[model samples]
Target: MDASIGRTAREQLTGRYVLSLVAFLALVYGVTQDIETVFAITLGLAFVETISILRDTPTVDSRWVGVGLGAFITIASLAWFAWELTTAAGTGGPVWFPALTALIGVWFIFDARADFADGTDSYAPDDMDASEMMLVLNHGHLVVEELRQGPKTVPELADACDLTESRVREALDVATDDGMVYPVDGGPIDDVERYALDESKVGGVAFVRSNGKRILRRIARPFRR
Candidate 1:
């Protein structure tokens, strides 16, 4: 009955179902010798995945990287298709063209899959609303929990949280502002900021996690109703 849990479950289910359907349709098109349909479907999926990455990632650099790579692949695919359509013989240039493009498309899909598998989407708070602020706090609390295991650089925290460095920095800012975390004394020469939880904070990681969960439940109550 927990709305947050239900919504998460539903999202997972829907993602799986949609992916499977796309795969099935692609296979059918391939089997029927409908190369155009297959290419269209592959392109559509790639475009969608690119948009999803842009929307979900919390950093400008990540967004730009995704957009750049996606645009290159899409443009390349379209160009190849155009060449095929406009050639003197009216037949495609070579088999490798479509195959290579298909491989690029598959790579994009796999990248999106990897992102989902690592739970990166959960790291970014959707908005500055009360519920979202609580989510941000929860994220910060989780970062603190990771730091309790050991001091970590921003990149390490980003890897742990499946988020971009910017997103991790955002969470750390919240924790730092709330006096839940503080910077470590020394770190590597790369100028990466290292963070550790403030042991002086009342109840430490346990308290933050517990309270954050309670707040999240309260926020999800209206959705359940």
Candidate 2:
């Protein structure tokens, strides 16, 4: 596999998020009984989606618009929740749930957004790590996302990703290629392998953090001149 990055952007959208939106909509409706609130929340998320698309990838150079928008929205939602909480007749009961959901949702988006921006250049020996990182992010994003929650077998990953078992296996292979994940019991991952997240990865968390610092340095370089 080519270790050089072949794509300027890493994917941020995936099936799990789609599932989340559907589930969130139902939960909000169940609690609020208000189409207006549902619309409001959905619209807010759509806005976040737009942000994820434009400013949250390796192609972007330290763009903060979408991330900042997410922060603003979460803060605003929490503020609303707080106000409602204090009122005797406050809709806080309803607002609190969505508000909390918004906080979680924003965080979820934020985490993905940051990760999508990772470029192996700043964090790892690109010649060695880039190809593997590319495979996992491009082909196994959903798989990796779920694994971050904990270890699982191919069937479990397929179910979570809404992909077929065969497809999940393929992605799992990509994940395992660069040690992104490994079987919980150790050794080569087999057909029934249960995989867990490899936290020491140079191509994931540290990748994103280093990318952030790289961007910050670039931004500050001009000012320092």
Candidate 3:
């Protein structure tokens, strides 16, 4: 399962890099064209292909957007170039220069729209912990501090944080998984009399609350360094 996830992530990263490089090369090539027609074709194709890869979806909306932007860039550039050619022949100003300059503007607008709709880097709730704000003020740093003071059972930690015992255990579980806290006697210690909790399980609530995304992030973070 992890291997499949790693493969998918790697493919996406590779596609992003390749698309970016293609876009860059196309844009550079477009700038050197004399008629600006080749520039329009190259620029539009680059934009479409780049955005399609970024989206990684073959949805109708995605296809329509790619087609529309490509057509718009090509048509608008050619039309402007024709007009510029006629004007320059009559007035003797620079031919293709005006069309080339306007193509830059068109490229910018298309790229901006693509970026806005890309959805590649947008934040989802899964990117952050739903319980993080409530329990851990700074990614459970305070909880870790409380744990390091002593082996305060789940209830003491919960009461200290003014949260439910379940919440405290949740926080401690996060701390434990993060290597900030570990079980003292190789496992949870019984303290049902002083602190109300299922002594057998220390971080059951935390583990339950955490979804797949958070767990993966935790596992990957260590390797990122």
- Best-fitting candidate, measured by TM-score? 1
Model 3 worst lDDT run, 10 consecutive residues: 119-128
Q: Candidate 1 has what TM-score?
A: 0.33
> What ranges in model 2 sit over 4 Å off?
1-42, 56-66, 92-225
Error of 1 at 189 (Å): 5.1
Model 3 lDDT per residue over 87-112, tens place: 65544556576567556545544543
Q: Please give, for residues 1-225, the per-residue lDDT of candidate 2 as tens digits.
A: 121122312344566867888898999999999999999899878775755454434454332553555576677777778778776867636765757756654863454464445531221113435675665466587888888888897778888888888777777776676677788763465545588988776456766875677677654432342
TM-score of each: 0.33, 0.31, 0.29
Task: Identify the runs in model 3 with alpha carbons over 4 angstroms from their true place.
Answer: 1-139, 186-225
What candidate 1 gets wrong by more than 4 Å, as runs, is 1-127, 187-191, 202-225
Residue pairs with backbone overlap in model 1: none
Candidate 2 least-lDDT 10 residues: 1-10
Total clashing pairs for each candidate: 0, 0, 0
Per-model RMSD to reference: 19.1, 14.4, 18.0
Residue 108, model 3: Cα distance from true site in angstroms: 26
Q: How many pairs of residues collide in model 1?
A: 0
